[model samples]
Target: MSAPYVLVLYYSRHGATAEMARQIARGVEQAGLEARLRTVPAVSAECETVAPAIPEHGAIYATLDDLKHCSGLALGSPTRFGNMAAPLKYFLDGTSGLWLTGELVGKPAGVFTSTSSLHGGQETTLLSMLLPLLHHGMLLLGLPYSQNALLETRGGGTPYGPSHHAGADGKRALDEHEISLCRALGQRLAETAKRLENNRG
Candidate 1:
């Protein structure tokens, strides 16, 4: 069997969320677990439009098997009207098979998001992602106040999950606090998953 890994799955339109995923993956590795990065294709309203099977750049599209076999998961996306982006949501909606089979039950999971403004519904977006994970019976993880970055973040950090304030143009880079919280979440999930696996053994 393949060694266990944490899946860092996200949909990034402006690259900010993608950067956060990278930081989270670093944290996952820091906790002695492999991090598998995956992304979903963009959704389109036009009936005739179709995304290529392979992405031209960045991470490849995630398959249900990715989620099925992951030891843990970190879900990230850019905020869309106080919720997750359409592409991420659309991809998740297709996971009914996993949900029915409980493939993700007991796995540690966390959420993160980037917003165009400081109050651009970061918390709501994070919560939106949590709903599906909850249904899948995953153990949800979040940054605690014990993390100094959660207390001192000037850009974006929350107990719900890590967040980034990308400004109106959506070009702002993630500040130190935001990055720290993202890594912290990743580390927490990895550690929790390891603990759960050990307990099961």
Candidate 2:
């Protein structure tokens, strides 16, 4: 059998969410799991618009098979109107096949987001990402206050998951606390998934 891996899937605009995904993937690797980073293409209003099969840069586009076989998941997106961005939602909306087959049931999952403002719907965006994972029957994980960064963060760390305030122009880098929380979520998800897999074994 192929080695188990955690899928770090995201849709990044202006790069903040992508950076968070990278941090989370690092944490996953630190916890001794493979991290597969994948992203979705942009959404276009015109029905005729289509993205290339491979993205020109950054992580390659995600496939349903990645979601189906992942040992765990860390989903991230840039916030849009207090919710997850449309491309991520668009990608997720197509997972009905996996939901029907319960391919993701019992897997550990967590969420993260980057927003342009402190109150720009970070938590709501995170929650929005979790809804579909719940439908897939995945075990959800979130950053607990024990992480310390969650309490100390003035930027965008939250108990719901990890978040980053990318400033109004979406140019701010993640603060130390936000980065720590992101890593913590990734490590927690990896550890939990490993434990669950061992139990099954």
Candidate 3:
């Protein structure tokens, strides 16, 4: 059987959220689990628009099977009106089968988001991502006080999840605290998943 892996899934418009996914993946790997990074295609207004099955550039598109089989999950997105982006929400809306089957039950999941403004709903976007996971019966994980970075972040770190403030110009990068919090979230999620797996085993 294949080894356990955490799915680091995300959608990014200005690339900030994508970078957060990479950092979280690194932390997942550090916790002794593989990180499967994946992305969803942009949504087009016209019904005729379609994205290629395989991405021409970065991580491949995620299938429902990927979400069902993952040992843990780190879901990220660029904030859109205080909620997750359309692409991520659209991909998740297709996972009814997995939810019915309870394949993700007891698994650990975390969320992250990036916003163009400091108060642009970073925490709310993370919560928007978590609501679906909760319905799927997955255990939600968040940064703890043990992770000092969560307390020190000036830009965007929340108990709900890691967030990034990409400034109006989108020039801001994930600072030390944001990066550390993302990694910490990944590691914490992997650890929780590992423990749950062991208990079931």
Candidate 2 structure quality by residue, lDDT tens digits, 1-201 = 678899999999799999999999999999999999999988877862267878989999999999988999999999989888889889999999999999999999999999988998998898988999999999999988889888888999888899999998989998899889999988998899899989989
As for TM-score, the candidate ahead, 1 or 3, is 1
Model 3 spans with C-alpha error above 4 angstroms: none
Candidate 1's TM-score: 0.97
- Cα-based lDDT at residue 152, candidate 2: 85
Q: Which residue pairs in model 1 clash with each other?
A: none
Q: Which TM-score value belongs to model 2?
A: 0.97
Candidate 3 lDDT, tens digit per residue, 1-201? 567899999988878999999999999988988899999988876852267777888788898888878899999999999999988988898899998889999899999999999999988899999999999998899888888987787899999999999999887888999999989988998888788878878
Q: lDDT scores for all predictions?
A: 0.93, 0.92, 0.90
Off by over 4 Å in 2: none
lDDT of 1 by residue, 21-100 (tens): 99999999999999999999888877522568898988889999999999999999999999999899999999999999
Ranking according to lDDT, highest score first = 1, 2, 3
**Model 3 error, position 109 (Å):** 0.3
For candidate 2, the lDDT comes to 0.92
